[model samples]
Target: MGSELEMGKRPPENAGNTTQVQNTPPNTHILGSVSTQTVDLFNPPSNACCFCWCCCCSCSCLTVRSAKDKRILMTVSEKQEDVDTNKMPQLTLEEVHAWGESFERLIKSAQGRVHFRQFLKTEFSEENLMFWLNCEDLKKETNKTMVEQTVKQIYEDYVSVLSPKEVSLDSRVREVINRNMLEPSSCTFDEAQQQIYTLMQRDSYPRYMNSSMYADLIQSFEQLNES
Candidate 1:
């Protein structure tokens, strides 16, 4: 009775079969171990080798997971690029002729903004144009969370008195901005934008119209039209 109990406790008489199974690939052993841990047999763990055909047979979960990770990374990269693009103003020749006609016409179009910004750069007042453009961009944002973040960034970069790029705003406007900052909104910079716009129209616009840069650009346009 003792011998029978010992034999029953021992493995199968096909000792060679047990040895053969033990000689199986390491990944198979890992798969079996993972299976015992309540892991979904259909979905292998991320650490598993995706190329191991025998161990990962019919299991494309790792491959799918890898692709999904790559897609998410790509999406984040694209969003970062968009943010950088937004921070810098865009220019186009969509209405180049209109811009060349008058300073008012030039300031109204995207191309005009680019040229005007170049002139402002020389005059050391480029912050005015940058601030105005940022305000315009801020107005188009509908996401409440994004609007709040953008408002803060604009205030820090162009509205704050300590900022190197700070626009020339009066004490009243500055006080209003400071009060509004406690509860920032998309329209927080409206008065500031209006003031800057008026400053450019009255001050910078006339100077730009009379500047050699404007005259040269107009001459080039006429030459192009004639050709």
Candidate 2:
């Protein structure tokens, strides 16, 4: 009752003539001092609060998960391409080896033709050769486009027929062979030869595709100069 009266009779210190009385509790003075000196130790910056922590953690997890998913997708795409090649007709080992050999021979002959054509272009007279020059240019342009199209076809076909699980080294080699052979711009004579040698050495062609049929096709094409 006495404390209540004291509180009710409290007055402002600056009220000089007013009926003023001190009503502040003695313990309140200690509380005020403690509160002022003891800083808010756990208080964080606005950007480092609980909501921010949650957001940061969530974002980090999502980023990691997304990266994993991307890697999985890329792996799946490659595997699908391998699968596509498996759907292609299987060839015996002997046939694949023979085909590889035939392909080598064809590549050699093609290189020879390229050399010959270049020689002619260099040595032939330029006078009255406008038509010939145009023809040569057109031929080169057509060949370049054809090779690009062929590589694309082989890549597509390989990706279409095989199961992702079954696509293996042999399939990869076949795809590489097709790609290398068709890439006229990048497949130099020496590079093509090296590719042929590598594939033949692997000895995977015989059992992977119809190696014999492929060999015969190559031989026929080479003999007829029908490339």
- lDDT against the true structure, each candidate: 0.54, 0.28
**CA RMSD for every model?**
32.2, 41.7
Judged by whole-model lDDT over C-alpha atoms, candidate 2 comes out at: 0.28
C-alpha TM-scores of all predictions? 0.56, 0.18
For model 2, the superposed segments whose C-alpha errors exceed 4 Å read: 1-64, 79-203, 206-210
Q: After superposition, how far is residue 32 of candidate 2 from its true place, in Å?
A: 89
lDDT tens digits, residue span 1-227, model 2: 13211111222333212111223434221101211111110110011111222123333332332343344334312331122222333322233234345534322332222222222223221111222222223234445544333223222222222321111124444555445443334232223224333433233223212333233333433432332
For model 1, residues 1-227, the per-residue Cα lDDT tens digits are 13211111222232111111122333322112211111111111222132321223355543444554444333221232122223334322225456656656876664467556666666767777778877877788887766665665677567655466667787788788877767778898999898888878877777776666665554543443454
RMSD of 1: 32.2
